[model samples]
Each structure stands twice: as structure tokens, then as C-alpha cells.
Target: MLNLLQIEFHKMRYNRATKIFLIIYFCLFFSITLFSSIRFNLGEINFQLAEQGIFNFPYIWHFNTYFAAILKIFLALVVISMISTEYSNQTLKQNLIDGLSKKEFILSKFYMIIALSLASTILIFLVSLGLGLIFSDFNEINIIFSEMGYLGTYFLKLVAFFSFCLFLGVWIKRSAFVIGALFVWWVAEGIIKGILTFRKQKYGIKDQISQFFPLEAMNNLIKEPLTKLGIVKSSIGVVNDVNIYWYQILIALIWTFIFVWGAYFLIKKRDL
Candidate 1:
């Protein structure tokens, strides 16, 4: 496994584009700290994000993970380009010629996917922990640790999404087409969901069936946390919401397996 990872590491090491994208991804990841300093003053309407208690314990776990998940697109560029560049540069063919098995190649890419997802999860966990400790009113250990399952959800979110991107990168072998494929797939899922939701009203179809879609499943893993803000809560009172759903995680796992296996199946069947 180390050898496989090292092989991939060296492939990316000298690529200037890979280096730039990775550095930018982490830089953007760390920039979430700046939200704590956000302030707005418009005439009598003075607002501060810090005072909103977004950084509060337990809640911070949810808030930070939700926010961090938005930044996946930046890292996604790395994953897509990683494979696309291999085909564009003839490296994929060269690697096979040099006696690296098809399975080993896929394993290298999958391992890197796991590593990147784990690293992002760890960074977000630390950032959330630090901000919560400094700002949360509830200091008890139980309160501090509660809702940490968001870290797991966040990790699963990235791995599943990145695996899909990796599969598209291999299947299409072009960066632009892969991105376009993602957009088209997202739109298709939305349309199908809308239709299914409509059918639920008339034909007694289950709305939960929409949750089986790849992107929707991944989205269902983590919900928006904006409604949890202090001001919103004060004004609207408590809203009934579940931050994480087990079914969403299971759906995402199924999709991740399908995508990774699909990518391998494609490579194995291709004449290259």
C-alpha cells in the first residue's frame, strides 16, 4: 500500500498544477477561521457572525462541517485533474507498460482519495474544536463532545464525492467533460427527485426513494446549519431538525462502492 501511494505521490510531486491546486485547497480550508471575525454595520443594523453563536460547542461541530463541505469543489479539481492528466500525458499507459497492475493503479488512486478525505476531516475537526473551546458557553465534556458525528458525516461526504469524481475522471479522461458530466448528473438528479416527490402526493410513491440517487444521497448526509443560528433560534423558537441521518450515510457508502468499482471495471475492460 505504501509503495502504491508512493508511486502516486511521485507522479503528483513534480506536477506544478497539482502542487498549486493542493496548496490552494488547504489554504481555503484554513480560511474558514476568518468567519469568526465577520462583521457588518449598516446604519442601525449591526451584525456580527461571531455573536450568532455559530462557534458554540456541539453546534460548532455541525456548523463547521457543513461549511467545510462547501469547499470540496476546490479539492475536487485535484482529483479530476489527477486522473485526466494521467491520460493526457500518456502516463496511464506508461504505468501499465511498466508492469503496474490495473488493480494496483486503482488502489493507488483510491488510497489517495481516503488520505485526502481523512486529512480534510482531521483539519476541520481541529478547527471546530479550537473555535468551540474558545467561544462556546457550555464547557462540560459531554456538551463539547456531543454531535461529533458530523465529522464522520463530513468525511463520508468527501470520500463519496471524490470517488465519483475519480470515476468520471477515468471514464471520461477529460477534465472539462468530467465537470460537465457532474453538472448534468446533478441536474438530472434534481429533476428526478422533483418528479418522485410529486408522485408521492398522487400515486402514494415513497419520497424516500429519491434519497437513493447518488448526489441526493450525499447531500442528505449533511443538512444546512444556518437555521441553527442564535438570532434565528431566538426569533423562530426551536425548529425540529435532525442534523444527521443514518440512511443518508448508508446510501452514500453504497454509491462510493459503486463509483470505485465502476472505475475499476472500466479500466479493466478498456483496450488501453
Candidate 2:
């Protein structure tokens, strides 16, 4: 298992696609930070009423949720392609035929995915902290650390989401199909959910159908106020109001296990 993991890590590190994605990721990271810092410096962006403290929670939440969310999507696509390309290129079969257990093969990919997700979250957090320092007059380090409790939940969400994407890729065995399905799901789901909620409220059936969507459960981790369901508030609030930290974590883990196991089962049972 250790050897397989090492091999997987090496492949991830050396892959040209991964290198290009990392370069793009870093470029976007710096660009977003610079833009935010410039806005803050120009007094064009005021996240807090008092400029003496670290920027308010809303700024961090917005930056993380919107900016980091795009990176997560690209990362998921790369992960899906990593495994799917191997399957498509017949390299996965070659690896398995070379004496590697099917279990090791699948688990190595899972470990690599999880490791990459954690690394992505950490890098985002560090960027947020560094940008916070550049733009805020307060003790940015302390404020960044204060909000760092959500890092674990964010990591879990990314893992769960990406694992599901990988499972789709493995089950479908086509990179284009996986990417298309993901794009449709990500784009259409929100619109469909809004329509459903609007229609359901008229008929008083809102609670019966909301939980069926995976995105709803997964999004509980980020707790975006605009996307939140149930209990509408009249006042503007910067903090996350959801108390489902443990529940979100649990849901993420359950989904991750299901997808990972599903991928393993498909890889083991299907003809290469």
C-alpha cells in the first residue's frame, strides 16, 4: 500500500496537467489577493465598520466561498481525469496486472485525492491570511486562525465532492461525460432547486423534497447565507448560522465512503 501510494504521489507530482493546473491556481490566487488588497487599501471595500480589527467574517467567507470554490471545482476535474485517463489509456490494467492488488490501486488514488484536497484547503487558508494582513490594520494572523476552525469542514466537503466526481468518471469511463455531467449538475441544480422551492412553497411541500439533492447537504459545510434554506433572516449577518457542523461532517464522510467504495467496486468488477 505504501509503495502504491508513493507511485500515485509521484504520478500526481510529475503529471504535466497537474503542473499546469498548479500554475494557474497560483496565478489566480495572487491575482485575487492583490485585487482584494487593493480594494481594501483604496477604501473601496469595507468589510468591517472598524478598520482596527481584522476584516469581518463576511469578507473571509465571501473570499473563501466564491474564490476557493472555483479552485475546488478545477481540482475535482483534475482528480476525475487522473483516474479516468488511466482507465481510458489502459494503464490502470497494466498496473493491476503487474502484481498490485486492486485494493491498493484504489486506496492509493483515494489517499492522493484526500491529500490534495487538504493541501488545497491549507493553501487557500494561507493565502487568505496573507491577504488579510496586507489589507487589514488589525492582527490578521489571530483573526485568520480564529476562522481556521472551518478548514477541516471545507477539506471534507472538497474530498466528498471530488470523490463523487471520480466515481462518476470511473463508472462512466469517459472524461467528457464526467465533465459534462458535473457542469450540468453544478449549474442546473441551483436553478432547479430555486424553482422547486418556489413551487413547493405555494403548495406547502418545501420540506419533503429539499434533502434529495446532494449539493444541498454538501453546501451545509460552507454555510453561504444567500444559498441557505430554512429560517430566513431579515437582517444581514456575516456569520454562519447553521449548527450542523457535525452533521455536515458526517454527511461528507458518508458520501466520500460511498463514492470511494463504489469506484473500487466498479474498478474491481468491471473488465479493464
Candidate 3:
């Protein structure tokens, strides 16, 4: 695994496009996170949650996880570009000719996906912890540790989202087309969700199926903390509003498996 990762990094070292994407991704991630943290810490935005310690221990996990999740698209683009570049350059076939098994090639990409997701999650965790310590009052262990499940939800969302992107990269084999299709699919799903929601409200329809959409399922894994901060209304009730749903996490896991399996199947069966 280490050797495979090393090879992957070695390839990335010479890839100008990969470097450019990564530079933009890190800049965007840091800029957004730092700006939000500084703004909230400085009281630039008036909100009741800040007083109740929304940026404080425990609660900070929820806020930070959400902010970090917003950057997953960058990671997705990284995966899409990497795999698609391999396809474009015919490196995948070259590797196979050089005695690398198909499975190893796919697994190597998966290893990179896991490593990137874990690194990003841990970095955001540390950032959130540091900000909380510097700005929030020391509270009880229970209060400081509660709602940490948001971190797990955040991690799951990244892995699932990236796996889906890998599947798209393998299936589409074109960076621009895959990325554009992903954007279009996301927008289409949002439109379908909205239309279904409107129908449910206006026609009194009982089908609540919109949440089952791939991205929507991943999103339902983490509800909006702003709603709990009294900034937005809870679609469900306040009692169950801030909590992460196990079923949603299960759905995300299932979809992650499907996307991964689909990618492997397509890669194995198709000609390079």
C-alpha cells in the first residue's frame, strides 16, 4: 500500500494539472474556514448561538464539520481529475502492461481517496479544537464531547462523495464531462427534491422519497446547525433537529459501496 501510494504521489509530482487543482483547493479551504472562524470569533455576525456557545466546545464540532464538508467538492474534483488523467494518458494500460494488476490499480486509487479524506477530516478536527480552546470557555467533559458524532458524519460524507466521484471518473473517463455531469446531476437532484417537497406540501402527498437521492442522503447525515441556533426552521422538530440519523448514515454507506463496486466493475470489464 505504501509503495502504491508512493507511485501515485510520484505521478502527481509531475502533473501540472494536479498541482494546480490542489493549490486552488487548499486556498479555497483555508480561506473559507479562516474567514468564518475569525468572523464568528470577532462577533462580526450577530447570532444567538454565539452567546449560547455555538462556537464553543462540543458545538464547535458540528459547525466545523459542516464548514469542512463544504470543501469536499474540491476533493471530488481531485479524484475525478487524477483518475481521468490516467485514462487520458493511457497510464492505466501501461501500468497493466508493466505487470500491475487491475485490482491493485483500483485499490491504489481507493487508498489515495481514503488517505485524502482522513487527512482532511483530521486537519479540520485539529483546527476546530484549537479554535474552540482559544475562544470557548472550558466546560464539562460531557458538554465538551457531546455531538462529536458530527465528525463521523462528516467523514462518511467525504468518503461517499469521493467514491461516487471515482466511479464517475472511471465510467466517464473525461474530466470535464464527468465534472460537468456531476454538477448537472446535483442540480437535477435539487430540482427534483424541491418539486417533490412542493407536491408533498400542496397536494398532501405522503411520499417522502426525495431524501433518498444520493447527495441528499449524504446531506441528511448532517442537519443544519443553524436551525438549532434558531437561524432557520427545523423541518422535523427541534427535539430531533440537531441529531445525526443512523439510517441516513446507513444509506450513505450503502451508496458508497454501490459506487465503488460499480467503478471496479466498469474498469475491469471495459477496454482501456
Please, what is the whole-model Cα lDDT of each candidate in the order they appear?
0.88, 0.70, 0.81
lDDT of 1 by residue, 1-272 (tens): 99999998888889898889889888887776765656778999988776678888888888888888988998899899999998999888999999999989999999988988999999998888887787787889999998888999999999999999999999999999999999999999999999988999899977878888888888878887877776777787977475566777888999999999999999999987
Between the candidate structures 1 and 2, which one is better when assessed by lDDT? 1
Candidates in descending lDDT order: 1, 3, 2
TM-score, candidate number 2:
0.81
> What residue runs in model 1 are displaced by over 4 Å at the alpha carbon?
41-43, 201-206, 234-240
Query: For each candidate, what TM-score against the reference?
Result: 0.92, 0.81, 0.88
Error in Å for residue 143 of model 1: 1.3
Tens-digit lDDT track of model 2 for 88-163: 7898889888887778888888888878887888787777666566555555445546655566677777888888
Superposed by TM-score, candidate 1 places the C-alpha of residue 241 at a distance from the truth, in angstroms, of 3.9
Instruction: Summing lDDT over every window of 10 consecutive residues in candidate 3, give the lowest-scoring window.
Output: 230-239
Question: How well does candidate 3 score on lDDT at residue 28?
Answer: 82
Clashes of each: 0, 0, 0
